[model samples]
Target: MTAGLLPAPEDRSADQGVRVSRSHHAARKVEVTSPKGTRTWSASALTDHGLPSAARRAYEGAAEAMAATDPSCQLPWTLLAGVGRVESDHGRYGGSVLGENGVSHPLIIGVALNGAGPVAAIRDTDNGRLDRDTVWDRAVGPMQFIPSTWAGAARDGDGDGVESPNDIDDAALAAAAYLCSGSGSVLSESAMSAAIYRYNASDEYVALVMAMEEGYRTGVFIMPVSVTAEPSPDRAGNKGRPGRGHQNDGRKPGSGATSSTKPHGTPGGKPNQDDPSGPPPSGGGGNDDGGTPTPEPKPPKKPPKKPPAPATEKKVGTLAPCGATWCLDGWTLDLGGEATLAKAAAHDYNHNEVAGETNQQELDGLSGAKVSVVVSFGTATVLEIEGLPYP
Candidate 1:
């Protein structure tokens, strides 16, 4: 197994029957996705006490991307979704969203970050490029990333070349990656606490996020009942599409995430740091663990000039936005012929251990195989093996 940044333990708060801070108000049109396709439902029919549909889609999308991009992080999609809810309400904290392509408009910037409150005092690290502040830096985006934190971990999940903190696609992916920085499973109670602490450092914040996640698992937070409806990019994504095709998104290996300040809990095995998340860390609260280093995100290299669907080692569809983790998504693997891997589970799967070319050997005789156990870092413990065709 790839060394975990920190083995995250299962959140104990799951047993708490935790509740979310936000009460659900039925939105007129709530979008949903499933085997049949995309659809929408009435907000008044019933409501889940959690994030809105769009926000939930972003979180689920990030979870899918991270299964390949940051396998070390074992936290479920709900955890990241909860963070987005508490941080900036999934980039809509103040009526902001992906207006064009996948960029969050009306930009989501935090306060001046003066350290007067529970937040730590963090000076400007990006020279006003990200936060637009020449002095104190603030957390930006739906997931609430400070400039420095975004620099190192930021990923262009939309393959837009630019790693904008405001984009929920990139921001959620980066946030999930940041949490996987330590060397333990985040499932254990200890590791779970540590992981949440890394994100915020506040016990209360952890509890709140934990509660929200529990609600999501139960019917408290629900996926819009799969129904027939119009797809709305206005909600979670462009009908489940990741990004706006291939843009030069100028990222480089070890770029994006600028410095080495750990965004979450320190690499140390401690507990209850009392750091509040959101905005910038004032040296105490928020992403101030300054823990260990995670695998640096590699920028997308221009693909070799070739025919469309470049075949051998070429990125296509959902795999295009993924940078260094492209191989993990089975993009380069020759699934014999015209086909791609479809995720068995829509919301639950490991993002890190995605199938790669190396594993192609296992599927060599798949033509005659009735059943096969093909696994790459999705969920390690649960092996939902079955014969699946490459899309």
Candidate 2:
């Protein structure tokens, strides 16, 4: 026997308006424009940190090697730099130097122990313990190597035999190798995120790394959108099952499948109906022996109707300042002000701010506008802007 069909549930009441929170609305408004085109993004998208000088050099050398060895391998240098920034704070660890006697020497160490020299010195008493030395082993060097994991993964990135943890060049090379090796070599956005998780071993590490990576890539830090806003039911023409308040089975009208009763006067069309071709009918419109007449030929099937368009509200603009420019929608407004430029930089605009530059001078004299400023470490640019009264 054929199974009975289940009825679909009723759709949720639209009268009970879905109240979108302010934060959700704000998050949806944030977006970034790249070569791939404009995309919606959250505020936590990119990070503003940088790699230590030592680590940066190491990463460059390693990237060059990878490029030479594997043409298809592509390591995002800026992403690596951003990772370094969050991991080691550009290798500004305060510690004492170690002498030839193997005793700890006292001296506050920054990015370099001396010019082009290996970082040495231990500022904290727990220098020997990886967990206790927050400035040294805690954060490690460029690529943010954990002291516990460094021994197994560290390598000489510059082709020099020595592998120093605090050396930026060595650290960066090690990071690149780690990222491009084993499960990390794929270089997908997800893979990069997973590799970062391996580096930190934190559940949230991927989100942090992605945010920083994206910031370096596009000069904007955005958050991820929540999944709640998407419609629960799959609409017609969508590539999934129509859920909940829709057709329970694949059966739809005009799909060539039988539903309810067949067209009238078409005998034997319904299940268990007797065959009309074998004998004449006993009705009044008879043939030879008082049989009914045959019915007309079946008509051609019609195409299915198109589904209604999904409802969409007008998208509001987000406030993003880069350098001398602020962006909203597709428009950009330039506001030439050092304070404004600095604010944009503080917020992680993807350019640098340098004195005596044309853009810097331009920023020194602007007013009445929202702007998107892209500032690197040393140079700033007015990428775009909007909503400004300035001429």
Candidate 3:
């Protein structure tokens, strides 16, 4: 497995469990895991991370509106959290670097501090001084709204005259609006999921959003359902054939009734014991006709049995760098030679020991290097070269 790429264990607490404040409705805690330990916070952490108060308010307001739009909209809110985490680390912006020309840019910085440089800054409009757009142009606000798309979707969700991308509330509201768009409804599992994918096009984004939404619903979200009745097949056919009655008796012999039996009061009623045409019923003993009892059905013949599944080899021990380990069922190998030999031993069934000794000798002769070897219950071979130059 690659280092630092594995997901953190889910049981860890978030950010030392520090709880941040939020609006009454927005007051929910989030747990995050970090090297320092797990820490917990509220929506207020967005502000502490350098998001302006106005932006935070906008995000909260948008969430409320989305909750009202559809309970499923919460799915988008969870996605919003992940978007914010990845794009701007919860709204801590302005960490860009400058290019050789001495202007800041929006490119990603290296892990080491000494290796970092200033990124180019962006211009909001056509000012023409170096001509770059504002850093916000790259990705701005709580969910990192890109300027080109934000311009069309951004609204005065809080009724402010100027709509700024850096504002959390504005960004969140824009995200919700984009997700609730026509195609979004069909795309999302719920209204919220649609909005999340609209914010960022990735399955990871969807998973993160779903996780956060699960947290939110447990706190204060509620969903409602609606129902409608559709026309039945009979009703639909009746619409096409205007005068068709429920019972159509106009038909030739063998078409309408034939030899089929009907219940006592049906249109073509039969003369069964329940009908008036039969003899008067005897007192609870049997039918007045005195019929004999029918015998039970015979059992069905059994089918042939199927064969059992093949058995698998049991692993007794592992082959290591020093030498092979002993096992009743198989053999092992040391790491001085090719990995292919070990792989072959693990899989091969006929050899009952290492089977690639000859192949390893031949490989060593050709490459002028030592070949690796592995012996086991099987005869599969794996090969690799040692002391080779880099390409």
Best by TM-score: 1
Tens digits of per-residue lDDT, candidate 2, 48-73, equal 23222344455566677655543344
Per-candidate local distance difference test: 0.44, 0.36, 0.32
User: For each candidate, how many residue pairs have backbone atoms clashing (under 3 Å)?
Assistant: 58, 53, 42
Worst 10 residues of 1 by lDDT: 1-10
| Candidate 2 global CA lDDT score | 0.36
Between prediction 1 and prediction 3, the one with superior TM-score is 1
Please, what is the TM-score per model?
A: 0.45, 0.35, 0.31
- Candidate 1 on 139-212: residue-level lDDT in tens? 77667677766654567766777777887877777777656544435666455555655566433344445544
lDDT of 2 at 80: 66
Candidate 2 deviant stretches above 4 angstroms: 1-55, 69-73, 93-139, 183-185, 223-391
Instruction: Judging by TM-score, tell me the better candidate of 2 and 3.
Output: 2
Ranking by TM-score: 1, 2, 3
